[model samples]
Target: MESNLKWLRSCDLLIQNAYVFESALCRFVQKDVAVKDGLIVDVDKALALDSQKTLDGSGKYLIPGLVDIHMHIESSMTWPGAFYKQALRWGTTTLVADPHEIANVAGLEGIHEMISNALSLDIFFGIPSSVPSTREDLETTGGILDEGEVSELLKDPHMRCLGEVMNFNDLKQEDSKTRRLIQLCKQMRPDFLIEGHCPKLTGQDLSIYLAAGVDADHTHQTPASILEKAAKGMFLEIQDKSVTLENVQTLVTHALYDHFCFVTDDCMADKLYAKGHLNEVVKKAMAYGMPQTQAIYCATYTPARRMHLDDRGMIAPGKKADLVLLRDIASWQIEAVFKDGKPIASYPIPEASFSLSLYHSIHLDPLTEEIFQLHGYQGKAVQANVMVIEPHSTFTHRVIESIPIINGQIAYEKVGLNLVMVFERYGKNGQHAFGFVRNALQSSAALATSWAHDHHNLMVMGNDAKKMCKIANQVIACQGGYGIVDDHGQAMVHLPVGGIISDGPLAVTASELEEVTRRMRQAGYVHDHPIMSFATLSLPVSPELKITDAGLIDCRRQQIIPCIERVLTDEDND
Candidate 1:
């Protein structure tokens, strides 16, 4: 809040000037704006002034600073600080972030890091609710949080609401733990907000979910879904990844814009740089035929209203000064960005070089010997059920089938590997659980993430029992990170950021991830980086299928089902 009078005196500042748009029916341009005490003191036709800094608004527009309703900073593949620097440069002055990835793996420590990062910048934190996403005991997580933890999180100054509560089916079933956590948040903050994750929920199930006090949803797959949720008073978050310009066109044409707001639930660093942030969403919406004012409203007022951020969604007196100055409305080019009435970003961009320092693992040690023991199998072939997940969607697909059981052990199948096993890394017990899956991890090598979906667990995916055990140990040895090893027992790549992020620059991490993905492809794996895919697979709240340490999960049934038939096969012994 330092004063900038050196640049404000001697005819230094311009008078009132603004390019105004309202209600999709009116547009006006004026030249009169005065800055003092870091707030727009006045805006009118003219003001007699001796200013030191004067900016010409010959033909430009002034709008409120953009707000991103929902986003995951972990998806940026960069640390929080680095993401903030780059994001601010693009006019994202305020962001609502869900640190579910870190919370899953590192538990409260992860959430603490998120809070610290948010405090360090102009941002808000939405505490994650579903950790160890599913109640699967077969997996080992970084940590766990019950009602007590949620209560503590809610007390934070930055805590806005309980993050996306993924276990909707469990909520429907009246699960005690789930209910208690939600109730705890309510007690902590009477009008507490809870985000939703019911992708295909409808009819009675949807009603029950809405009744639980969940206020918003980012998983709307269709206009019908948005309409259904809106009918129940849920704020629909329009996603950039799932809802593109083509589909946005349909929503705008249908005039279903009021109940919706824009959010980039997961935009990678590369895409954020190329396409822009909240501003991009606004521009795309306009190009798709959404009225410019409507687009601006969706990007600003609507989300601010939903979040209850009453202090700064408009450009009037008494409102916190957060504004975006644009060169034009058509191209949506940002000219300058301001926060609290002081220009924070302008032309002549600085070189973008970001770095992360990770102290190598010193407290953890690698297992030089085999740590897993298997039982209940006999020969070379066996039957098993599998789990599958679609791309860019929250729900998973569970399938049951028969496959090869090699050497008295279940083999990792490439074309249709149905079941995969998970071992707890923190426990010497080496408890092994299996589940059915499809559409990812086309390789036999194990893929682990401390960044597992809802609950950060030591999630390992591989068909080979021996390699799965080995990779799990390696991940544990690194204390946390992602590791992929070949079917022939060869190490491919390792990025040990609490088993979640890479302690390197975004470009470096992206390059290493590219190499790991390349190796997966070379190893006969057909899917993309199965590493990032596993993060969502453990989320019990999404839908269809997922696995925790418990075993193969039937999310709808809210219980773990066996992946194999009762009969034992010869291959189970390997």
Candidate 2:
């Protein structure tokens, strides 16, 4: 095998007969080019540099490789290789991924898997910071990562900066551990790029957040929100997760596009293979009235600069030579992709390994039949507790005390009942939190996942504690999976992707999710889509109310409260 560095001394191939976007608005054309090894040593009109191969790109458009500032590899349901294969098909050459979901489920081992996967691939790694997310008492997690644990993880070359700091509430309220984390990262990398996760912050609070040296955000839910933060100098990561073409339109017309870049925070696998990655985002921007050049720059230079990735994201000499050729500016379809100046056949698989331990389960022991047994039904119906899902956001609606009970038990409106259970998956006992849910659940035997965001603990909610117990136990039974049991007491569906993702394709998972949705609707769930989002809304770290293994958490107050009222229900309120 020839060394790429040795090949750099002589040109291997070049193409110069194509239009190229040199800068935001400049367009230049050349007749011949030179690629030595895997680097573009020289590009010129005259064929001056010696080359081994040459190609005519008469009608193509050349541009720098597209970079994704923030994304999760697991969301695609495919491993990192599939992510790169699909991403490269659309001209995405690099990415920055947060393995928080995996970290919540697997802890240090999870971090190791992410590090390995990232090393195997040609992407960047933003080290995960908030491993368990909220405080331990607020919820259950598969694992936790403190400063000491994370500092060791950051030593890898692929580990660039701290992952998204999702616990802004903890940092803002002056939690010592949270404060220590910030200080530690700062001390280690004085100029490190710390990602922010302040969703819907405003005024003085936003000011304080910025003052804390937070750098970027992908949580802008509105155009005004983007403008507000951009004016304050925060790099806004324009996203396609919740934002559609309509939202992109509002952004390009209303806000300054320069401060914003493109990101697909949670695009499913089908979307990547079908539509594209950052390249699709650029087309979406142009369709919304953004100039072609500006859209490309936002996808390339803007995010690259924000991430401080100097060697990539541009078409300059003495760089890594990652480049993309486009069919045109309007469509933005990728013609070819190059990594290190060589046309890559496919995306490389990331350095990753399958690992499972006590950290993978919210509870080590499965929920036993005794724990989920029901005594009898009572006629004294009253209000219970509930967790609400926020639309188009990572945050959840707070855990509220406004739920209805039926026959002396909590019921979800006339749909069925709301039941919640927590399993101790960390190989410990006597500290597990369990309780009831009302209103939010939409089915009779339907159970939802407790990844409950940030924390990877198992918080299964259903109308039947036995069924919830079965679902919770199934997680242990299968190592990791979201489960739903029919009223007939059968395991209806299971998704076992690292306990958080499903190895099944997205469509199959979506179908299984649909089955869960159908059961919920049949039993009386009244939500627009399936209550899958309800699983995330149950997170205690975000806003509103949420339930953890510890108990019901008031996100606004950052504290846990009793699942049941201390006094008589109806009489007490009266």
Candidate 3:
């Protein structure tokens, strides 16, 4: 006790008698931690430390603050400040975000705006590797981030790694732009990580993609893909959707914890509020049979190591005092959170500022019912290609259906189909395309949003043309947001920043999203996440079929296909 006086006198804060999760050993041991100047000075058993502040962590579990290596702040729909505040409450002290959603709308300016708004040291960014997400002819975006933009962003200190390389198809070709971006990242920052987004890629294709220098992937994974990717020296970032029993058991049984970490790729406002952030993922992983120590390690140490953030992620000497005190390790209940040795409860809510131009991003002429009409051959019926939404998945299947023509317009309702349309809102071109969707909105209502994935274009769907036109115009009127016109009446949640982010607080956004979700479900939108499912309809790179301003896309073929395959005559109808 006498010898400990010198160290105790210099300690700024001391947490005594807690089960400290030693990440290096992947186990917990009772220890007292000493902190000074926001860095851990000592961690040992029964240290008689006296300090300015000391907390009796007698029954708590002391774990490293959670780290989310891959996520999207814009997907929360609020500004960066709001997201930071909410995340910290859930004990997530570190985050690596991919701002590609905003980049697609505002380009480099949008990326700069987000970086400026991030006033905290804990939040880092990845250079958006695929701002357009696909070829120009496949879809229209408000902005593009090509080689020049990639080169410029790599210079920023906050830019940790290249964001998820979403253009997997392009990476196969040597001269493709995606491959060039990978080469550029390697040349500029060879040690930096390169994230990936190759869903369902397997065998030789997956091997070829990894050969292109992508270090990690955070897409949905099957059991086989998980093992294969891990075996091939690729890092796995398991998000909420991939936290299944089979996936978690595979990791535990095979002892594959070292090669993988957890991430939250695109959590919506409501989900983040009600369910939690990376902490929730940790909980689910535990529930799915992952040991507590392994789960915590993956959420903290592994993610930090993956991002090359060596300063934090563990309770060790000289490490940043980013820690979480939990009342129960089994339930993962966080009692207190600290950042840099300071209690996060005392930290003020962060504020963010945006440019005036971000609020006025929508640049389309007024939409009308006439534009929603699909003009076809003046015949009795027409054979049209329809996009069928698969249940519980983003992949859509193409099917041909014969629809009756009324007044030179395809009567989609006659065959139980909904009209889906995409319009270029960038003011670059007044391009528009029409298609038919199965298992979308079943009521005589319309829903429109400028939050279309990777494009930020105006996408509308409904059974009634006039209602579709009304909602589409309403979304444009608000600059960018979700607009719904159903039996309950019009509802919206404005996202004025880059037409992909909300300018309001997280609570307001979450509440509005809840209301909008309730209305959408009432209007017969069948999806677990109505907003995300509807928004991603225009993401051309997602799967078998999708729609964009260019037209209906056969994603596998990577080309635009016509809406009307052929006009059916009387003989064909018979």
State each model's CA lDDT, in order. Answer: 0.64, 0.65, 0.87
Across residues 120-212, which tens digit of lDDT does each residue of candidate 1 receive? Answer: 566787888777565545344555777777778888878777888777655766666677888888887887778877678888878888888
Best by TM-score: 3
TM-score of each: 0.81, 0.84, 0.97
lDDT of 2 at 7: 56
- Point out where model 3 deviates above 4 Å: 1-8
For model 3, residues 1-574, the per-residue Cα lDDT tens digits are: 8756666567888999999999999998999999988999999987766689999899889999899989999888988888888898888999899999889898999999998888565789999988788888888887799899989999998999999988877888889999898888889888878889888888898899888889689998878989999999999999988999999999998898889999998878987777789988999999999999999999999999988899999999999999899999767688889988999877666666899999899998888688877775588888888998876877778898888988887889877799988999888888989888898888888989998887989999998888999989888888889878986688888888888888677888898888888888898888867788888889888887899999998887788999888887767744
- Name the candidate that leads on lDDT: 3
lDDT of candidate 2 vs native? 0.65
Count steric clashes of candidate 2: 21
**Between candidates 1 and 3, which one is better according to lDDT?**
3
Q: How far off is model 2, as Cα RMSD?
A: 4.4
Worst 10 residues of 3 by lDDT: 1-10
| Residue 57 CA displacement from its true place in model 1, Å | 3.4
